[model samples]
Target: MTFTLGPKATSAGYKLAAFDQIGSTNAEAMVRARDGESGPTWFATTEQTAGRGRRQRAWVAPRGNLASSILEVMDVSPAVAATLGFAAGLSLESALQKLSIEANMRRAGTEPLQFALKWPNDVLAERQKLAGILLEAEAVAGNRLAVVVGIGTNVVAAPEGTPTPATSLAALGVQVGAEELFKALAEAWVEFRGIWDNGRGFGEIRKLWLERAFGVGERVAIQTGTTKVEGTFDTIDDTGCLIVRTADGRRMPITAGEVYFGTAASVGAA
Candidate 1:
């Protein structure tokens, strides 16, 4: 099915650029931004040939999977722009939950899937990584900053033996297609983005995110380079840093790290 923006997104003046296959939707969006494409535009595909996730890790989406990115140019600080990723996470989670419910309705006695937003940028289903989000920003002329939020979901395929175990919508028995998910995502984005209000409404977003957050108040270990920090997942601060309450009663804010949970937290396993 051809990709198109939902009614809300279209009415909000958002545009879409759908692709059958692409090296990376994030890369395409950034390239467009460099070419003076000052947009609230979406670049999406079901087959991503060469995608990259956080920390430069490869995030290739095979055929039948979904890889998408949205670009926005705004006059905000980089710190403020970073919080936008939280909104992206919330948008996708909302979309997934809606579709999963609809899918479950068509079947008999099927348990509805549980979805949660992971710390920083991931969506978890049954505690397995179902989607990842990456945000990139660059300063442009006229003192405006161009930011791209990339979201990749396992619609029908997931790689084996990842650092964190991965799962797909098909594997979870949701029976959703990339086209349908993208349409829902576009609509959800419109709602959450309006609520986010370009970072001004992040307090509300933060509260909503924590309500659907995974691993909160649970043991978590974060590895930043050679250093490792272990503590309970306290909360995310105003700027979206992962707040870990250490054993010594210090709330340490982690800006970036590879996270591990439960028993894996002790070993700092990949």
Candidate 2:
């Protein structure tokens, strides 16, 4: 099938490269960045046979889902990369709201799912898995730097047999087309970049993320490669670690890991 660009995507400042299938959009973008591709470019694909998640787990892209990678060479420090993930998460939540699913669907229960932002990267809807963001960096030829930010939205179907519950916009009964969704996402990123570029700070970004955060201050469990810790869901640290308050009242900081909440917790893959 031929790939199509969003109606709002202009070819003037941005290049939209599409593929029918690829191993992974993020991987491809990283390769291109290493080869010196510069500034505000996007790589999207219909299907990713070998997609990847935070820990290199397989990220299956069934047909109709949105898989794209963004390349940028911002003059920001690497510390700022973490906040960009939250910024992207906020942007995705905005797009989902634009789709106008039921309020309950967006949040989940009484303390509904809040469309919270999972640390580093991952957007959660109703406490179930909804979307993920991956960031990779490479040093340029002239001591410059570039970052490839991969974003995957389950516009249709999700992978099966996963530990964390998976969900999609279609499954949630939202019928917005992928083209429209992509437009909203890209626009959101552009706006987010402006805030990030200025010294607007991560405090404001963290506040937005926490407002919709799922299980914040609630009991939670996190597994980071063989170590599992149960604690109260605290706020995300300045550097983007999800701070978890342990049983002994000590806050254990987590940089990257799988997190879940409740007895039937909906975990998100980092």
Please give the CA lDDT of all the candidate structures: 0.94, 0.73
Writing each residue's lDDT as its tens digit, candidate 1 over 161-270 gives 89889999999999989999999999999999899888999999999999999999999999998888999999999889999999999999999999988988987634
Q: Would you estimate the TM-scores of all the predictions?
A: 0.98, 0.85
Model 1, C-alpha of 162: deviation from truth (Å): 0.8
Expressed as tens digits, the lDDT of each residue in 1-270 for candidate 2 is: 344444444533767777877889888887887877886788887577888888787787877888888787666667666467777788788777766544445665533234666665777776678888888877776666687788898888876676667788777766666666777777676666555663256777777778877778777888777778887888887677889888788988887777777764334322
Q: Pick the candidate with the highest TM-score.
A: 1
The superposed Cα distance between candidate 2 and the true structure at residue 40, in angstroms, equals 1.2
Q: Deviation in angstroms for 190 in model 1?
A: 0.7
Candidate 1 backbone clash number: 1
RMSD of each: 1.0, 4.3
Error of 2 at 86 (Å): 1.3
Best by lDDT: 1
Q: List the residue pairs that clash in candidate 2.
A: 107-112, 107-113, 107-114, 108-113, 109-112
